[model samples]
Target: MTWLLLAGAIVSEVTATLCLRTASRPGAHKGWRVLVGAGYAAAFAFLSLALDAGMPLGVAYGIWAACGVALTAVASRVLFGEPLTRVMALGIGLIAAGVLLIELGAAH
Candidate 1:
């Protein structure tokens, strides 16, 4: 199903992003370096497949970015004790709204 492909896209994107974080830290192990490279490659490969399946680029991109931002923010706050200010919440809300708008636009 298309939804499954989209889910794959989300997973790969998140993996890639998390990998980048792991890779960026100084002195990461070789395993982490391999993971990061594989993650990035898989992310692009999955996303490209999603695009090839007739999804609009804008819609796919919007969904991917929105999901990434929302999930990553919550995860970082929980895992890293990162701050979550009202301004950040507002920004995320706006991002959600924009994603909704993109979805609605696609239906017309």
Candidate 2:
């Protein structure tokens, strides 16, 4: 259940951030603004549950940020026609590498 909550939090966090970005554009979507706020509220609530479930904060946050970066780039490209430039790809790769190192180092 905690894992589920954690995943939900991550998804909602990402959704909120994306929606916020969209909402900032001209002719903002009021619906998305509402979603952004709701999603963030849900995210924090679930994250609290996740912490209560004994998942390490470091691991949870690392996973959340890495997924957010990778998924958002992919989502923007596929869903919103945003360009996935080589630089963006490289930055994501670095984020992945850094997260991998963090996880690996924490295992000791």
Candidate 3:
């Protein structure tokens, strides 16, 4: 299903972003760099598949970007001890709401 493909795209994107953060750290292993590259490639490939499956560009991208941002922030907080400020959390919530609106509108 297209939704499944979209979910894969989102997860791959978030993983890729986290890998990028790890790759940027001091004394990071070279393997993280390879992971980042491969993750991004897989993310794009999955996203392309979702789009090809008749999902509208705006709806697909909005959901992908919003979910990626939210999930990445949470993952960073848990895995890398990054801060998750109230303002950032609120912004992520807003992104989710906006994506919901986009999806709802697309259904009509």
Top lDDT prediction, candidate number: 3
lDDT of 2 at 68: 78
- lDDT of candidate 3 over 14-66, digit per residue (tens): 99899999899899999999999998899899999999999999999989989
Relative to the unseen true structure, what is the C-alpha lDDT of residue 26 in candidate 1, on a scale of 0 to 100? 89
The order by descending lDDT is: 3, 2, 1
Model 1 scores a TM of 0.86
Q: How much is the lDDT of residue 65 in candidate 2?
A: 75
The total of clashing pairs for model 2 equals 0
**lDDT winner between candidates 1 and 2:** 2
Cα displacement (Å) at residue 41, model 1: 1.5
Q: Which 10-residue window in model 3 sums to the lowest lDDT?
A: 91-100
Task: Report the poorest 10 consecutive residues by lDDT, candidate 2.
Answer: 59-68
Name the top TM-score candidate. Answer: 3
Each model's RMSD to truth, in Å? 1.6, 1.9, 0.9
Q: What TM value does model 2 have?
A: 0.81
Candidate 1, residues 1-108: lDDT per residue as tens digits? 555677687777777677667677789776877887787677677777888888888888889879888777776677668888899889889988998999899999
